[model samples]
Target: MSDPTATGPAVPPLDADVIVVGGGPVGATTALKLARGGMRVIVLEQREATGLEERATTFHPPTLEMLDDLGLAEPLIERGVRADSYQFRDAKLGKIVDLRFDILSGDTRFPFRLQCEQSVMTRMAIAALDEEPLAEYHPNSRVGTIRRIDGHVEVDVQSGPRRGTIRAAHLVGADGMRSTVREQLGIGFHGHTYPERFLVISTQVPLQEELPDIAYVNYIADPVDWHVLMRNPSGWRILFPAPPSWGSDEDVLAPDNVLRQFRRVLPDRDADAIDWVTLYEVHRKVADRLRDGSTYLVGDAAHVNNPMGGMGMNSGVHDGYLLAEILLRGHAGEEVDADLDRWAERRRAVALDFVGKETEGNWSALRDDDEQRRAAQRAAWEALGADDEARHEFLLTSSMLSSLRG
Candidate 1:
């Protein structure tokens, strides 16, 4: 599965045209796209073959189109819940503003959000790579050390008995927050952690059927109980701030408390309806640089943001797409490193100025309890709800398209 379009003088012979560490959605997408372009790619992942870790449910329009271009949109759409609209509301279900994807209909073929587990996209990407002979996927290959050599980069991967070193003209660090590539390259990942720990619980009670007022995606504001509730193929997922009374990590995730939280929403529901429960902390961050010589960072390794608007995964996939396009041009006799620098600068700015600020603002809008602040926020939301032009502009930023504007 060599890159059919990879022409011109080539990179020196090596293990691959690019070596990607982290076979999650971002890494896999980068590998698949590069391989399709006729370049050799190898994806190294620390987890087992194929990811089924249920997380990240919202896929924006641009991301859906990219998946379609790669032949995955139909399968994903068939398995996902199409959410044409989402809302901003109070904790008690009083809607403040409702945004319709129809505003973006002219900008994209799919003018809606898809609510499916991140695992769906990961598995599909892996299946696509399996058919690509030029792409190799190695699971349980935890990256150890990273070294930048004369004209290439060296990555040491450790697995059961296959512990060895891999050398490639370029390395992509989609490995995640504490990325080995970023650390060895001496890049700083500066960010702050939210004080309120987050908790996610699933239920089979059919959120939309029971709560007719709610959309497939809903964001509720509450000074003490800010939360997000959404419906997907998996079921109904409710993510909210953990209580201050939580004594220990184990205490908050206990089955009793988890059930208590769900029962609070629907006291009549039985145990069968409650499914999965998880708790984690949220962060907002960006790397010092996206590229350091022959090595480049994408996805979580490069940036992170709160899950308030489901921007993390979407932005990461966008990172992969932008980087792959730049690398493809570099192989065609363009200024390689210079192009990477440009990509890094632009993407990093998006992560900081666009994604970071947007997510933070979303959280602030929901969790702000001050009387004056809440009123001002409500006025803004009302304006967005009433004016078509303003709503369209806001949606552009919310959907991550404004980041591409000149």
Candidate 2:
């Protein structure tokens, strides 16, 4: 608990129309949007600088639209690789099924997925923030406490050696899974971690012989391990399901271990050229309530999904776009409480219906040891790929275009 009115030598008073906690993609985008809409906005980031992790690389159609609205799509495309199609292979059957994005050319400006590192996306977002004159960015600042006052919310922020208070008409928590703001507001995030972990490895490999011009390739129904290979700007990324008892978080997945696993699944490849490798535990969860009076939650603070469908980051960016619109309307004295609620409802529905379910399905299909189940999974893919309408629907769902409002 922090005293709202206590002004000391260490505590400074800061005021803004909106206070955004977290400097990740969602928070930065929200702050930029709010400030661009004529609101004085402040962004508090706990890290001194943005993280350069290879978290997400695929951006769906709706996300591209959002990026276009933010004037970032062009630059991103300039630095990204376009994935026009995805292939699903059955190792046991020795058969492959491919789905092309061009088939659904009527729905979106970007029918294809963009394969760019998340660090590149963050850089673009930060650049967009720099263009917003009304946005104040405070790096290395952590929000210690946030509370709703009579007409405004007060946030206690600690930046290195300095502690300060920011009073704002509204607040948004986009601080991700372990959201301090969400915890302070007593929001319940209900979810569970997956039984198996995922090992992600990136390297410069030419898949022209086996996978020519293919953007995304998934080796499904493998009894040993499930794998996904995608074309990155500079190289390729290989994602595989790790055994439940692989290693602890503190232990890093060494190059040798990564190569050994690659050899097991993809034996023909040379493993000496590995770039980076990591192990991540997958989780699926969402907060009970995304909003509490003047304070709201966005991004991973609201919901977290497995990366199988690559929906987590894209969904979070969409959260920023929708929440920004609601906040803008609210700031203009419009009735937006219902709209805010609608945003949460719609996003939560999509998360559960599409993101959560798809990831779970992917996990089940990949990890199932039964030969019958693997054959069933392969049959489903082939059947879906062979039918145009079925393939379109599947593409719409997988690309996240079906989840958008008309």
Candidate 3:
């Protein structure tokens, strides 16, 4: 283990109060929060440029509330679609339950899912960071080694031909799942990968015109073919499970195969309507710990669940927000050891217990082949939807308000 307790030379001049090792949504959130809190912050990102890919399109209600607090929600909502309700559907029988976010009106201010690409949030955050004098945003900067010295953290960064060292009071690892900080710190990420890869097809097709009575988001369950369909500002996105039997990547991404999946939703679906396709593996992994000495992990570096309930990115944003709050309190000399401990414990617990199980349950419920279980699942959704109180409670949990509250 890289021990922060190891005796070292005196602390050197600090580059910033906190050094954030990624410039994505989570790192931007952490850096912006700290900079706004009157701490000098630096964000290092290795990407040369941002892509137009539609990654992580669903933002739950509580996540928007948190972003609103950071002054980032409104612009994103303006550029995105608002989904007031989502449906649990059966391929053969049709919609089983239409769960509306309006049921969470009393529980949260933003009682709807914001269907915006994550790039929008990151761009807005980076723009905000650029305006803040206390924050420095560095792109094309890759972080290497991490070392602890005299109660501070030091990191090696490589940007182009320049090699530099930055020392900070603390370091936050929000760099995606393949995080350099986590690897350098020797932290273990424990979990399993799903056998079937997930395939996402982005299309400009107005699916609402073709499908009857479809909401902005729909989870369609079928014994033979389970999939998720959602609408973004661009148009629509469909997710399908790609078993190994699907053949090679080129074969699965073939135009004919893409259209086959679309035709499963609607037989007359046009092949030319599809814009692009992506195939990637999914995993349910959580880091062994959120904090190791003065360095902390947030976002994908800390935990990653399947994007079933759209909880992966939302929960990661929550991590950055909560960690920043705790760190700010500690900086104020408020004796925040307990606060830090509580934050770490609670965040990890949420990842493993709440998000892990919720997403796994979603995937399982959608793909279960047994007729009895399908009937029971449908009845459960009906019972939950029929009762106002029960529906409200269910919406609270699904919208992530209950998770944040607890």
Candidate 4:
């Protein structure tokens, strides 16, 4: 609990209109947008500097559109692969249906997923932030405490070599799943963790070239173990489901065992050709509420989900847009409490109703041994491809344009 009256000795002045905790995609996006609107925004990132991350490689259509609007998408497009279609396949490598994004051309200017590493986007975001006179990104700054007083929020953080306090009219927590802000605020993140561990292996093997039947992104279903195979700038990534029974996370990352697992996808690729690999625990959770007074939660700070359909980071960036728009209106003297509340409510709704349900369904459809259920999954996927209207509708929804419109 923060003591409102206690500034504790001499305190630094309120530095900005808003203080954003976390400099990941969501926070960076939020700070960038707010700064663009002529608001003084300070972004606090715990990392000493931004580094390349192998995670969150897919940017859906709507997110790209938003970035384009901010003049940040063109460089991303130049650096990333444009995935025009996505597919689902059986264990034996038979296509179920190829959902083409081209069908969404009428609805969105960018009708494809941008397969760019999040590290690339983060660098671009920070660069854009550097250009904004109203914005300041303080790296190596982790939230110390957030207090509310005088109808305003004050954030204390350890930034680089200095500990300072910055006050603002509002604040945001976009740190991550294990957000310090969320924990200190005592928000309940309720959900279950999947029993299986997940691993993503980078490979030099040209999976797209070797497996001509597959699209750039392929979700292959199996009765027991499901996997996601996608193309990256490096080469390819095999997202595998590893149970603890297989071994510890370290054992799963062991080169020989990992190569053996790749046999399930690539029977001919040599072991030594492997690039690198990593593993993580998987969970599905949403905060009990995204808002606590004048502060808000967005991105992984608000929710965490399995990367089944590549929805986690996409939805978080969406939260940035949602929050930034409402806050901008409020700064203009508009009554935006309703809009801010709507942002929190609608984003939470999106986490459960869209990201959660869809991703859970994705895993269920892949590993369910029941033949009838498998057939239904295939049917639904094919329906997304074969029918023109249905295909357009599917892309619109899956690409998250519908989520925004909602």
Best by lDDT: 3
Per-model C-alpha lDDT, please? 0.85, 0.81, 0.89, 0.86
Instruction: Write model 3 residue lDDT over 52-147, tens digit each, in one string.
Output: 676799999888988898899999999999999999999888889988888778778898999989988999999999999999998899998889
> What is the overall TM-score of model 4 with all chains considered together?
0.94
Error of 2 at 295 (Å): 1.2
| Estimated TM-score for each candidate | 0.94, 0.91, 0.96, 0.94
**lDDT per residue as tens, model 1, 1-406:** 6688999865545788899999989999989988887778989999877655557999988888888878888999999999988998887648888899899988888888899998889889989999998899888889899887778988888883336888898999999887888898999999898777788888877777777888899988878767889988978898878855776779988878877777766777766777878888888889999988878899999999988888888889989987888888777767767777888998999899988999899998999989799888888988998999999998988887676776
Alpha carbon deviation, residue 379, candidate 1 (Å): 2.7
Q: In candidate 2, which residue ranges exceed 4 Å CA deviation?
A: 1-14, 160-162, 210-214, 247-255, 265-271
Candidate 3, residue 146: lDDT: 88
By lDDT, the better pick of 2 and 3 is 3
Model 4 agreement with the true structure over 194-236: per-residue lDDT tens digits: 8898888788788877778889898999887678998877788
The TM-score leader among the candidates is 3
Candidate 1 least-lDDT 10 residues: 46-55
Stretches of candidate 1 off by over 4 Å are 1-13, 160-162
**Clashes (N, CA, C under 3 Å) per candidate:** 5, 0, 0, 0
List candidate 4 stretches off by more than 4 Å: 1-13
What TM-score does candidate 1 get on C-alpha atoms?
0.94
Clashing pairs in 1: 2-38, 3-37, 3-38, 3-39, 4-38
